[model samples]
Target: MITLLSVYVDLALGVVLAFLLLSLLVSGVNEAFVRLLAIRSKFLWAFLRDTLDGSDAQGRSWLPAGVRDVFAALPFARDPRPPHSDQPAPAEAATVPAQETKAQDAVTNLLYQRVREIDHPTRGRTSIANLPPGRFAGAVLEMAAAEEGGVDGLLAKLKSMGSPLHGHLKGVWESAQRDLDRFRQGVESWFDGEMHRLSMLYKRYVKWVLAALGLVVTLLFTMDGLEYGKTLLRDNAFRASVTAVTEAGPDAYDELRARCERSDPVPCITETLSQPALVKVFDHAIVSVSVPAEGDPAVHWNGAAWWDRLTTPSHWPGYLLTYVALMFGAPFWWDVLRRITGIRSRHHG
Candidate 1:
């Protein structure tokens, strides 16, 4: 009974340690993919168009009707394909024209200028992922109002345009008894509230994209979790070595994450496997009976060889297992491994 229990415990430790390292490597790749594509900028562009002009990502329809317009837009940016869009896309999708024209209107002009002001180095000025409401309000009041003739002139223009924003701003101005600072503060608060809604929407989209990326990565690597675990289970030397590493604590996970932080998917994976701690676990004398290529290793990863294995029906479960394990994420497994190690330490103590 004691020997069997010892074997089971080591098997569990080896499997959990392997998964924790795999999740970190996969997560780094996912982040790199998101950065490379600038998906956040795409999401933001969708948000502006849906909320603004109800046409473009203009501040018009959104600002005029206030929070109701933002609430109405919801997650409209997910499927940005035209012919199906609630509102038709202009010639250039999400391109806020720099030059002001009668066709663009006041709100779009403001949005275009704001995009220029907040353009980040990483995503570039053309497509932006983030903009603060405070800066947005300041732009409207400073640039938009300066040209119009200060607060009074801008207010007079607002009264004539018949915009939804007109009523809200006027109420704030009147309630503040025409105090400039108070009015600006009120407008800033309004923009801040609405911007928060867009942030939440962006995050929800990111979660779904991560899931899709996770599946793609599993397929590309031909990562079969179930099969790998079975191989290690049968190897007493490997199981014992891995259990020792796992029992030693989280040093294995921390070291891998640091090494692979800047690496792409393939390198990230190789770095984890080549880690001194784990490499030592794999450095055992070969004991197999069959010697097809005298010195050729039993397990070698290649796109051609793995792709064939991936197509086999028996290997499908392994792919599914790897995908599910990666989705749990590195942080989740790290915590689980720590608690597990703690339990073992206490038991031995």
Candidate 2:
């Protein structure tokens, strides 16, 4: 029973490694997709739109029609329009030029809104993307100074605008007001620090994108852990082979991880398909589930149809488990493999 259980554990480790590999490839694809789709930038723009252009207490957006148009025009931007629309989308909407114009308009409006009180009140606008944080600090201070209540007024306005820095900015403003020169420098530093924090905020959203992509990949591969486990428990020869592979130590898992990490998605998928790391792992699982151990050997392969397994609703729980596991990525699973091996070694000892 110990040996049998170890074999089952080893099989699970293999499945985990396999999922991790696919996840790495999925991650690579997701990174490229993010760039091609400009997902992060769009998310940032949407964030800015929600924060900079204030919303009502009831959550209705107070952003101007033009500003909302700018956000909607972003690459892979969430459509603000209702899903059920009577009017058809314009033909020009399909063209790249129209999208480019909307992107330009968004950039212009965003910068104009930021510095209208300080720098470009009339002239269309400049790109805030390249504006130095020191300069941005100067601009914000100028706006604050222009207000009736000085820094305190700016803090209240910022809070009303839904800016994340309301409390922090208020603290800094109150503490630094006594020493004006020192306060100016502090504000500049604060602006630079906040800008860095903004970039990190976009990175957090990327993890969500990875999770969504991982779920899609898990379903695509039909990686059902429950089905796999059932077969691993039943097949004596297969279990022995997998257990021997695991007994070879950490190097085996590391090699699989390295293969997935270094390879591109197309090549990774191709190589995995051509020569699956575990020969007949899935095939045996499918066969075992479809045919009794005593069933005719030749007909077992015929019974292991791909569609039959893919469509099985019973496999969903396992598929969800696989999806959740994939989010932890390859390195995490490598550590798990090592720990499992250590536990098994100690148990035998």
Candidate 3:
């Protein structure tokens, strides 16, 4: 029993330590990805700009005029000039009109608004000047954004931070140290929730393990006690007391002596002793018999029987406790698994 208990204790300790290490590992990996994403974001934006300039007309207009004209006649040509730059050169420009200036301003503002829309701190969009003309431009822009290192950059930044990706990683990293501190607090809160759940599960496992061990120990001790009690009843003093009272007339004495020496002596003795006159004689003889001064007393027939010894009130308390544990144990484990794994099962019943 002691050896089993020690083994269980060691296993429980190892399990607890392993869980702690695993949690730390998960947290560290998540933060590292966040930081990597930040660095990747910077380089990704630069690459996208370069790629657009090499392929698109609005971007390629910086090239020689001959090259621009050659590419302009293509089926899917792009205008090298800025949108609305066709008004005129400053010297030949017409006088300002209020309505026209307002309209131009609106167009310029719209362009700026579009730029802002795609400029996420973690995943900025690729330039639209290189995009093919179509109603699918918006979708193409998003796809290009994802392809041009946007998703990779975001993932890298998360890796670099050595933390999990949350909605607040971007603005918090961009801001001052104080903002970063606040972000850490939020991450800490998430970690705390995870830790709490793990602690609860560990406690529950310990309880069930202890309960099983306790049951085994109880059964072992009970069986051992019963065996020792049987040994005590077979002593010389108990056998002598049974033999003396059964000896009587010459015929009876010879028969009883023969039965006493047989290999299965107890059954033959018990049958002869059941006679009313023989039982009275044996009872009186058993009560008078005594062991030596240093030895324990011989076994005797008492009103209290073996069944009386076997029955105990203490068992009721243990059984009640086990029942309560069983009632709650399943639900408690189910709730813990649901909270930790974020899995829900739907059942109409």
Candidate 4:
């Protein structure tokens, strides 16, 4: 029988290994396909345009003709169109007035800077999600005030569009003329209050994206949580070997996180007996859990149909459990690993 401490240690180690595998898988997918998909980036661009761009006489966006082009010019900008579409060129679609070029440049730059600042408050040094609500609101207001006509310029730009909120905004702008700080504070308060909705929207989109990626990753790696757990519980020698490999380094988790942040996969894989070592444990753990290699049993070619391998009554549940665990991300599992390891050390000492 397995000792209680052994169960905790095994479970914790399994979580750690799962996290590393999922982390690598997420990074790999992002590197390979995020630019190609551009789902989030396109959504971000459209959301910014709709939120910030003013409407013209024809009820179309008046926020300069080359605004999209300008955005496309930025680093990491994603064009929503296919690489070789038969559609009309952007220049053929929208024409800008010569006089409006300067204004367009100003507005585009302001919007770009503001959105970038609000979305990535650490000046692109950190994850966009790390930007707090206060900093995000402050960045938006600061950028608005920094525009051509200052706060009034921003209010005028928004008012020019004649949005439904124009009347209320006009009153706010009028009051802001008298007390800008108070206006900013009120706007910040409102923005903060609505941030939960924004966060939920972001999470909803990202959750689906990650779920799709997680499914691909789970199948690609053949991760089987139930089988892996069973293997660890039954194999003392394998468990001790992997645990010794992982626990060799004191700063292993921190180092792994730092490297992951930098996207330095080389150091993560080969440098330590941590990331790759953890992955090896996972591989060995699931070795006995087999999936279909070839084809339909109906055709007499195989052990099981591919669909049966994926969705049969006995198989998919474990794979799905593995994918859900991957969705928890590395940091969460890393913390669990630390806590369980600490507990073991205390108990043994």
Best lDDT among the predictions, by candidate number = 1
Q: C-alpha displacement of 28 in model 3, angstroms?
A: 34
lDDT of 1 by residue, 1-349 (tens): 9867876676677778877876777778767765665555545554554433244333333221333222234223232211111222222323222333322455444455544644534422244556677766765566434443566665565555443455666776787687778878887887787678767765555566567767876776666677666665555543344455468855545544444567763465544444433233322212212223247556433555555766888878988987898788888888889877784334653
* Candidate lDDT values, in order: 0.55, 0.53, 0.35, 0.49
From the highest lDDT down, the ranking of the candidates is 1, 2, 4, 3
lDDT of 1: 0.55
Better model by lDDT: candidate 2 vs candidate 3? 2
Tens digit of per-residue lDDT, candidate 3, span 63-83? 223422322332124222222
lDDT of 4 by residue, 260-334 (tens): 456674454443433233344333321223223355322223234333455556656778788878888755665
Scored by TM-score, the top model is 1
RMSD of each: 13.3, 15.1, 29.6, 14.8
User: Over the stretch 247-342, how does candidate 2's per-residue lDDT look in tens digits?
Assistant: 985544543444467777346644554543334444423343233335554434424465576678888898887788888886787677768666
Off by over 4 Å in 1: 1-13, 49-54, 57-124, 143-179, 237-304, 341-349
Model 4 lDDT-worst window of ten: 89-98
Worst 10 residues of 3 by lDDT: 88-97
Which structure is stronger by lDDT: 1 or 3?
1
Model 2 spans with C-alpha error above 4 angstroms:
1-9, 48-74, 77-172, 178-181, 188-208, 230-306, 327-331, 338-349
Candidate 4 segments whose C-alpha is farther than 4 A from its true place: 1-4, 27-44, 54-110, 113-158, 163-168, 174-177, 187-197, 237-313, 343-349
